[model samples]
Target: MSRSWVEAERAMVRRTRLRISALVALAITVLVAFVGGIAYTAMVHAQDAQVKRELRYNAQFGSPSVPPGCTWLFVLADGVIDDGLIPVPPGFPLHGDLDAARVSGQTIEREIERNGTEYLVLSQPSGAGRTVQTVFDKRYQLADRRHLLLALAVAEICGLLAAAVTGMGVGRGTVAPLAEALARQRRFVTDASHELRTPIARAYTRAQLLARRAAAAGLPVDHRAGLDKLANSIRGLGDVVDDLLLSARLNEQSAGPDGQAVDLAALAEAAVETEGERAGERRITLTVDRPAGPLVVTGVETALRRAVDELLANAVRHTPEGGRIDVRLRRDARGYVELTVADTGGGFDPVEADRLFDRFHRRPAGPDRSFGLGLALLREVVTRHGGTVEAISHPGRGARFTLRLPAADPGVVAGAGAEEVSTGFR
Candidate 1:
């Protein structure tokens, strides 16, 4: 896919996550506000109703008059206090909004402060243009409301925080697939670059030969060698491309119908046979040590063959002329099989040994070195076969490269229930 298209999709996912989080937060805020408003109004309503009922009962019954924590003041039409009532509570206000209540003979409730105490005052017209005011202390009710408001505020904050955390998780989850795709794209590019270096080198070498020939002789040059080199380079490039595509396909197939079981020992022997000519060209001594039992593994035969070829080729390249190269295959007690390639070459620094499997990584001291893709390709194939590759070397000491794979079970058709293992570089 195009980079722009991928970016647009990711942007849309991010926006969706943000919108979902915002909607959740908004819903919670609205719910809390609605519930809190109802609770506050109900609390105030109950307090007012209670005060009103007490006032009306005392006025009608005239028995034991005012209730505890409540006070009353009756203002007659001539502005005189009623002498028939009991004494009012200390710090309670005598004057309320009498004029306002008497204007329409309706109850006027207001919060009043007198002598440093708060009260809920209800003023209403009693009769004959007189006003009766009822006062109820509100210290405890106001405190309760404050605590309720604090609790609601805390709840609102917690709800917002939870929404934010959930939004972050949603965003990461949404982007995970895109991130994996981008990673695969980058890996393809790296692998392709590493593979292309070979053809480019071949082409450059052929061009140099043509240049030297033209410089030596006059005008018309022989196109045969040049054409042959060009063809070989193109063929090599095509082979690398095929190998890369096959590697990708193998990696992509997680639990599909993988190929049948192949004998690993036979594969290693075939690799040794194939690489024998190449080692002979450099006068290198190559040997293979096989275990008595047949070492079988479940994987693609072509891929496994390529893996062995790459390993042997690597050992031949690193080993000096007439050096010894040993290929050994062994099965351990833990039902794991290992293939080791130990060569008596001028070894590299052990610290940098692990980087040998990385694409295009080359040792500076190596002579006539090609772009480093052989080891990397080998690692990829082995990893797909549920195997791991390891590089063991030290400066001045020969390098030992090993491939460890899960051994196939002896029973039940001898090959099943195997999974690819994640591996590190050789």
Candidate 2:
């Protein structure tokens, strides 16, 4: 579950990074386009100014009663337009059609023919009548705008690539720690289970030998009591082993394995009955509240049953002899199936409830108590089956554990609830 949560977080971060990068790229493209447009406009304006200067110089000097060293021609008119080109001196350098000559209050634009070359005429204001000027077409400025646009396009591409690379790198780095933590946690459970199996087996064998020897001697020994203790110890070891293996298997299954419908209600009742028999004359009452049909779930049946059995065993072990115990299976408001186990023993330490499911955590140690693995195993079983367990306790009010699981077929209606009233005895 934690692993899935971390992956979800990484996905969100990746999406956010992509969106921000896109926005940045768009902003850069717009800014570059705007700057390029301004630069192109400036270039055209400067070129036009130079063309006007040349026209004015020619108007003041050297051409057909014009000033010396001024080579271009200028034509100014007020009303009617002229289609013919203005005559120019011998040395002008451009060629184009001269269209018209015009001078308004502050502007003069005219067509000028220079050395038999035709060009468009432009006019700017002078002392009295507007000064005439000629402007060539803006082919050079247009070429510059095209080149600027190409460069900006390349830069935007590079920026997007850089952003994507950086976001992925950072996201991977952030999730590395979470992965390491999960690996260590799984390994700890597996190694602990394997290590405890040896001592538990040895205790069971020794207890069996003692019982056999006592029975042969006909000493009226408490062989059953010794055997029960050994059995409980062995069962505790099995619980731990089951939890560890189940955790590992679920890890694999959730990754890719397929699951089928499992009837949890039936599974729970069978487990409770079996565990109740094991309790033998201990004052523990077994109550099962189940619907008529299957409370099916999409999961491995074995894993789910083991989890329920662990919870039952935990309640049995913790509750004092003759204390009431109740087990209920019902659906919650969200249509989730819940298996609840409640015990009316002297309640547990409220503060310790938080670590109830932790491995090797036992409560209020006593001489006859077994190893502290039952709750931990229960937690593993539920987790593997995609379920949740929560414990609520107080000083005197007994402990309650609720295991919530999603229903396999939401279309199935839940049956009526069941209540049990019975004496707590083995």
Candidate 3:
């Protein structure tokens, strides 16, 4: 499958998940706000109702009789502000709004704050010329309301955090099927590639046999040339298939017998020398710089060699004839062994840097030798080795590709192959 189509499928899955998660979170937030508002309002209204009930009871059954913790003021023949009835709390302000409300013969209640305390005052006209005023301390009620508000605020914050976490979980769950399908596709590629190996080997054998016959019989030069080309094509196809299978299977990695300590500096020197010969053929200058001491790592030597070879191969292919290629190995500040290949070639567009490692992503007018799977497989292999790789480039300037592997201590490398087993096939 093409890379774009696979990316589109993943994009669709992510979009669907985001929309579903967003809608769910929005619905939950709205529901929580509605429920909280209703509950808070109910509690406030119930407290007000309790105050009003107390005011009514005091006004009806009391003329000369007064409640224990409540004050009453009268405004009638019998309902005068009788000082003998009850002693008023000090510094209480009597506003003109009270007289206007009594003249309109409407019951009015208002909260008053005095001396850092809250009080509820209710003024009501019981009958003609009978206005009764009562006051109740609301210090405890207001404090309870403040505590409830604080609790509600805390609940809201916690709920939002939980909703965000749940949304992430839901998104993953929703996209599980799409992820599984991609996995199945990779597995199919691996299986098909594995199945085609024997047939390819047989074809290669047949082509070699034909070439040998043409050379001995001297039938025609085209016979030899065409058969050689056929053999080369078959071999290339087999290589491509092998690469595909390896890329698919790299996720399931294990430390095998060949996963012994490797001298990184030595490996790099060998790759440079091998590629130096090829670079000479292209008239490109190849250079290598390394530390005097050995830089070691715990990994498969063949895999690391392939990685360096691929980078150098890319450099040679991209660089113009007589252009320069520099391969360097050094220890980074983080104690990682870094291998860098820089070439004076036509570099790629910077905007596409992020997609350089994606499978089947061929640059426009790229080299014919590339199947667009080299960097992708390189990424998988390096990541499995606990390393990282990146390409740095700018158009019309040049390109530099870097591979960094964590350096291994000499002691660790020495202890690696305590039990030497069979050296397996690559």
Candidate 4:
């Protein structure tokens, strides 16, 4: 039981780690993207302001005949440069006449291209023989865009990192309480089982001794029967303790070390034999049918044995006197080996069939005499082996419990023949 808690804790830790990492990455990405976009927008606006200021200065100052400043070397009249004015640079468009600049009595402007750079142009009449022309370089605007994009990329990376860290914190915070609850529950089960086992064993032994003495003394046989009944009840309690301890150990070893290979077919046969020996008076017969040669599965032998034992025990306890119990181990269509325990007993509620594997669940329509742990324990065993357990039943018909296990690698282990009763790996 403690082992189960530990496994849960480990799983929680792993999940928390992953969740936190992802969240932190996501948060950081968003933060960086938002900050970088704002920064880029501001940079673009600043570049635009600078370009517009330069254009306004040229318009207020002069024409192509005179340079307003070093930055404004030429201004045009309409679309052409005035005569006797040299071209400021080879890429600059020739200045135009005042008449063209005054067309329609309104300014007509457009962006122009020069020397692989963008320039914003403004054309308006300054006065006679002059037209105001302004051109602002757009290279700085392009450079600002590049810088902004680079900043955004950097911000995105930083955001991702921050998100990862924050995610981890959140995951850990969320899982801590759950882990603690799991640990406490496991401890309770383990401690309770351990404490109950000693008293149950002692009670069973005392009752048996009393019954034997009563028979030897030839006292009232009916009184001895009562003692016998008490003994059986105590024995049943012991069985429950055994199941708890077995579950605890199996859960621990399942994660600590992988189970060794054992012949599942052999195990099934042995379990059948044991069941028959104990339940013969009930007229329960055990049979083994195996078409698949030796079938080896990876799991703790004791746990698997207990699981098989539970299935057979359930069949025997519920099967009517003279009823047949069939135990078969064979390969399924999916290539997995299946161990099935079928009994001609009072079948369970079809609706309750699904809940049989749940711990502490008893069918209201079926047997009133069950601890409800048998099928649950069986499920744990099958799960540890990376297998599955299922129950099929119908009212007034027989019931079947099927356990499916992954087929063992033939190269590593071979199937044991039916003749061999026991093959201990230990």
Candidate 5:
């Protein structure tokens, strides 16, 4: 395996592990928060119930001077106050509630905050127009609540950390099999393509020789035509095998330190030149527009060249006779090298645009139908080099394919002034 392929696999594994860790941490965080919220709420409710029970009991039966701890009592009879001699906290013994209970002859209860603590007060008519009131302090109960909260916060943090660690371990084990499977698949493709290339080449050569000999021997027109068609079919098969091999190799390539700066403008010019004769036979006009300076991008040069050639060849094949194909190369404002191949041909359905680059996807039955490997391979090459490829078309409106790659450092392109020349082909 290439270093780039190994690095890509490692990066994928790392990303998967991180995502798993994040999900685990999130689940744990939500669980801790929910449990903590419920615990705190239940504690507060229990404390309120206990405090109310104590206050009601004290109001009904406790003496003014001998009330329970954290409790105080007061009595009002015939407008005479009977508060205990013991010192009372500020804002104690709510006289309004006492009077309201005496006049209404009913129980009254309320909670008030004072003296840096919460107090629950209850007032009720004892008998014969007598009113009794009791108060309970909630400072101790509040302290208990704070302690529980602090413990829960600590537990939440610990749980999150544990979840993240566990998730990472689980993720590594989970993704190992997937990574191995991908490695095996890539190896199989490489091996199979290598095994098939020589045979396909030989078959193509023999077919071509047979056609040439049949023509030279003055074979009948029909026999010669059949041999020519056979030769063409073998040639097409060979091309498919070559494309498969190139696709596998490009997948393993990366724009690492081993990559070289390639002039995209020059590649585009060469592709157009290579396809010029075929386009001429079809009476299709081929043209290329490039910047005066080399539009440089970092990648494997042969791969980039093949990608460019595929784009031009695809355009030539799809375009009708007398149609025009334009190739343009330039560095966009975003500091990326952009190459576009636009052809005036019978464009495909707009819905099929996204699937155009899918390997072996069947095209609409027409003269433009293809084996469907070229665009897929082109996409593989561009993506491996950190780029994007897209197609735009409307049926009968022609199609445009554009690929953009990260431009190499300007300093490198500046040094290649020797190859900076304008190229234009008709």
Candidate 6:
């Protein structure tokens, strides 16, 4: 495998592992937060219940001076008040509640905050117009809640860490098979293409020879035509095989340090020239417009040339007699090389534009129907070189294909002049 392919595989594995880890950690975090919330809520409810029970018991039976720890008592009987010996902590017994309970002969309870802590107070009528009030501190309960929260926080952190470790292990096991399958598929294509090339070439060559001999021997015109058709079929098959091999090879390669700076303008001119004769046979007008200077991009020359050729060939194939096909190359404002092929032909539907680059995707039955690998391979080449390809078309209008590739350093073409020029072939 090429270095680029290996690096791509490694990058895919890393991304998968990271995504798995993130998902697992998120699930664990939500679970920990939910469980902790429930636990904290239940603890707070139980503590409140306990505090209320203690305060009610103290109000009914405890003496004013001998109350329990963290508790204070007050009594109001026949308008004479008696409080505990200990000094009241700032906001002591609620006198309003005590009077209300004594007059109403009912119980009253409330919670109050003071001095950065909480207090639960209860006032109730003991008997014979006597009112008893109890005050309980909530600082101890608050402290226990704080301790529980700290423990939950610690547990949540530990669970996230464990989730990350487990996710990494699972991701490696999950992604291994996928990576191996891709590698195997690529290998199979390369091997099969190599195995089929020689036989296909031989068959195409023999077919052509047979057609030429049949004509030389004064065979009937129908026989000669059949041989010619056979030759064309073999040639088309060979082209498909060649396309498969190139696609596999391009996948393994990338525009790295070993790549050379190639002039995109020159490649466009050459492609137009190569297709000129075929376009002429169909009476189509073919042309190329480019900058006078070399629009240099870094890539494999053969692959770039093939991409340019495919674009021109596609245009020529679709264009009707007397229609026009134009190829243009230039350096765009973004400092990237751009090549566009536009043709006056029976264009495809707008919705089908994106699918045109799919491997083996074919249009409706027509004389120009193809195996559909050319555009697909072309896109693969452009993408491997850090570029983009786009198609635009509407039914009955012409189609346009645009390819953009990152420009090489200006230093590579420093002295090359930049002037607009157009070349036309009838």
The candidate that wins on lDDT is 6
lDDT of each: 0.69, 0.60, 0.73, 0.70, 0.80, 0.81
Q: TM-score of predicted model 6?
A: 0.65
- Cand. 6 Cα-lDDT: 0.81
For residues 231-276, could you state the per-residue lDDT of candidate 1 as single tens digits? 4444444444544544444324352215556678987986686678
lDDT of 4 at 366: 52
* lDDT score, candidate 3, position 117: 81
Candidate 2 contains a number of clashing pairs equal to 26
Pairs of colliding residues, candidate 6: none
Taking all chains together, each candidate's TM-score versus the true structure is: 0.48, 0.48, 0.54, 0.57, 0.62, 0.65
Q: lDDT by residue for model 4 over 1-426, one digit each (tens)?
A: 454667767777777878777867776676677787788778878877776677767677645565544334344444555522744545554344234566645565666677777776666666665566565567768876987798778767767766666666665676676777767776788789889878778878888889889899988876887676667556656765765665555555444214467788887876675566667877677788986567887655666777888899888887888888888888777868888889898878888887988999876555667778889867876887889898999667689999999886764464323323222111
Candidate 2, which segments miss by more than 4 Å at Cα?
1-74, 78-192, 195-226, 249-325, 330-337, 342-401, 404-426
The per-prediction CA RMSD against the true structure, in angstroms, equals 14.3, 10.6, 10.1, 7.8, 8.0, 8.2
Per-residue alpha-carbon lDDT of candidate 2 for residues 166-241, written as tens digits (9 for 90 to 100): 5566546654455557666766766776677667667766766776676677755456655655555565455546
Off by over 4 Å in 3: 1-26, 35-121, 124-129, 133-176, 196-259, 269-281, 291-294, 348-362, 365-373, 390-397, 415-423
Off by over 4 Å in 5: 1-15, 65-71, 76-119, 123-131, 137-162, 183-261, 276-298, 321-324, 328-339, 351-373, 383-390, 403-411, 417-426
Please write out the lDDT profile of model 5 over residues 1-426, one tens digit for every residue. Answer: 555567778887888888887888888789988999999999999999888888888887898888899999999998987887888888878989999998899899888899999888888998877899898888999999999999988998898788778767876777867877887887788788778877877777788889899999999998997787676556555555555555555544333322566888987786676678789999999999887977888766666777888888888888999999999888889988999999998777888888989998657574454688888978877888889999999578689999999998877666554443211100
> Which ten-residue region of model 5 has the weakest summed lDDT?
417-426
lDDT of 6 by residue, 178-223 (tens): 8778878877987997798788888888898999999999999989
A best-first ranking of the candidates according to their lDDT comes to 6, 5, 3, 4, 1, 2
- Is candidate 1 or 6 superior in TM-score? 6
Per-residue lDDT tens digits for candidate 3, residues 321-423, read 9999988899899989999999999888888786989998877677676788878867866887889998999677689999999888768667745622222
Worst 10 residues of 4 by lDDT: 417-426
